[model samples]
Target: MDVAAIVTAILARQAVRDPATLRPGMRLDDLGIDSLGRVEVVFAIEEQFDLSVPFNANTPDAGGFDLTSVGSVIAAVEALLGEGRG
Candidate 1:
């Protein structure tokens, strides 16, 4: 699966924005994704990839997974997938 495409799709659905306009550098908050939206994103990602994401809605930073930007999310998911293979 294309990580960037999937991540962007999930974010676009949550933010109600155009997927074409969602760039890797764009922050989740800039897209109007609040805590609830973020949780939804995490859930979608987990379901789509069939892998668990280390995310905590209350303390997002506490988890090692990076949720700072669209690119970071793609990278994190890629990393998690790579780990599963090893």
Candidate 2:
């Protein structure tokens, strides 16, 4: 599946508010997703694209790993896929 579909499915599985209702700058707290939910989303994305994303306690604070919004997550996944393909 494509990034958007994978993202949508991730949100759906988490019972998050519809991604259609989300925007790029929205905050994760606004969507009711805690840190655990963020990790779940990350794992789901890895499984969806068969790509492994590096992580550490500071990972989310680093660039492109932020899951504050659906669009951000999609963009991050796209970047990771591009890196893997390269």
Candidate 3:
């Protein structure tokens, strides 16, 4: 699966924005993703990738996963998938 495409789609749904308009550097806040939306995004990603995402809605940075931007999410998911293979 295309990590970027999936992540972008999820973000677009939560942010109510167009997937084509979402850039790699765009922050989740910039996309208007609230706390609940953030949690939903994480859940969707976990289901889509069939892998666990180390995310805590309360302390987002406490988890190893990076949710800084669109690119960071893609990178984190890719890294997690690589770890699963290893």
User: RMSD to native for every prediction?
Assistant: 0.9, 2.3, 1.0
CA deviation > 4 Å runs, candidate 3: none
Which residue pairs clash in candidate 1?
none
Cα miss at 28, model 3 (Å)? 0.3
Compute the lDDT of residue 22 as modeled in candidate 3: 93
**TM-score, cand. 1 vs. native:** 0.93
User: Which tens-of-lDDT digit does each residue in 1-86 have in candidate 3?
Assistant: 77889889988988988899999999988888877888998899999989999998888899889887888988999999999999
How well does model 1 score by local distance difference test? 0.89
Q: After superposition, how far is residue 9 of candidate 3 from its true place, in Å?
A: 0.8
Q: If both were scored by TM-score, which would come out higher, candidate 1 or candidate 2? A: 1
Report, for all candidates in order, the number of backbone clashes.
0, 0, 0
Which tens-of-lDDT digit does each residue in 4-79 have in candidate 1?
8988899898889889999999998898988888888889999999999989877899988888789888899999
The most accurate candidate by TM-score is 1
How far is 31's C-alpha from truth in model 1 (Å)?
Answer: 0.2
Instruction: Using TM-score, rank the candidates from best to worst.
Output: 1, 3, 2
TM-scores, in order shown? Answer: 0.93, 0.76, 0.92
Reference-based lDDT, residue 82, model 1: 94
